[model samples]
Target: MSAADVWPIVKARLELLDDARKPLIETYIAEIEHRMKHYCNIRALPDNLLYVWASMTVDAVRVDLPNADEIADTVGGGANIKVGDTSVSGGSSGSGVTNTSKAVIDQVVLDYRVDLNRYRQMRWGG
Candidate 1:
């Protein structure tokens, strides 16, 4: 199946977004399809699972894109920067801020079983 087939379910899962956001969502869907292709043949997977993954990936992307500016700033100089009276120094050890949405997406990608070893084991015998 294609992202176009995944679009309706993705849209249904999301909150009301403006028409301007439509293109962004499309872009995200395209990205998902591209990324999934590298791991395994998405078209080979069940349509139901594809719908679930597409819906989830779109949500993750939706949450992540808005934080793009904040993420960039944090990577740039956020550790040294202070917010209002609170010091937002990224954290001790300078690991920088965590992108939770990205973490979720990464986990989801694993759930999709894109790894060569895992995918092969899943598709074939142990």
Candidate 2:
């Protein structure tokens, strides 16, 4: 199915202004299509799964949006946040670091019962 076919679901999942998010949504749809293009053995998934994947992609990208402008300045440092006289500071360095967005997306895929291996292309006879 085309991006237009699944746009309503994507929009509802995002819950944002259509004008503000349409470009990003299109980008994600394009990325998904491009990734699947070379995988010859990929199974034909249901439309719901495709919609979920698209929504997940949007969510993954959204997680990074908050830091985009800050990162573009080439200035890196800890974040100092204060709320109601309470202060908190943290940096992007240290151990036990995990990509929370990816983890969450992975969990969502599992919740949806997606078989990720189906997207892989098999090869035989080297």
Candidate 3:
């Protein structure tokens, strides 16, 4: 699969990864980048693309991926974002959001999805 196509799923997986284990996720990426050309016959993307893909992955998984700390900064003080359910409030720190906020956010949902075809086109240029 093209790197672009795989980015969405990778982001989702990384989001689910434990906060402490996120660093290791970078390791997986280096190898994936290397193999995208050799193993998967994908065109080699510039390092910028790799970074962009990684960033996109983190976002898809519903987490902040600021360059300030890479994976370390990913897990912020805010409540964890569940795949299908997400809530936002002024205060990230609180008792699981106020009853009123909960009611409002209950209607908010983020469905995780990945499109591999996009990656294929970007990688194979077909």
Best by lDDT: 1
The alpha-carbon RMSD values of the candidates against the true structure, listed in the order shown, are 9.8, 10.2, 11.4
Task: Kindly list the per-residue Cα lDDT of model 2 for residues 6-110, writing each as its tens digit.
Answer: 666666654544356577657766555444433334445445456556654554443333244322122235654222222323333332213453353444344
Clashes of each: 0, 0, 2
Q: How far is candidate 2 from the true structure (C-alpha RMSD, Å)?
A: 10.2
- Write the residue-wise lDDT of candidate 1 on 32-118 in tens digits: 665555556434544545665565565454445433443223324434432222222432333433455346455445555633223
Q: Roughly what TM-score does model 3 have, to 2 decimal places?
A: 0.29
Please give, for residues 1-126, the per-residue lDDT of candidate 3 as tens digits: 355455445656444443463444444454445533443344665453554445434443233222223333345544355323433322233324223322222222112113222343434555
Query: Please, what is the whole-model Cα lDDT of each candidate in the order they appear?
Result: 0.49, 0.46, 0.39
Rank the candidate models, highest TM-score first. Answer: 1, 2, 3
**Native-vs-model 3 lDDT?**
0.39
lDDT computed for candidate 1: 0.49
Evaluate residue 93 in candidate 2 and report its C-alpha lDDT on the 0 to 100 scale: 39
Question: Candidate 1: where is the Cα deviation over 4 Å?
Answer: 41-46, 66-107, 114-126
Per-candidate TM-score against the hidden true structure: 0.49, 0.46, 0.29
Rank the candidate models, highest lDDT first.
1, 2, 3
The worst-scoring run of ten residues by lDDT in candidate 1 lies at: 82-91
In candidate 3, what residue range of length 10 has the lowest lDDT sum?
104-113
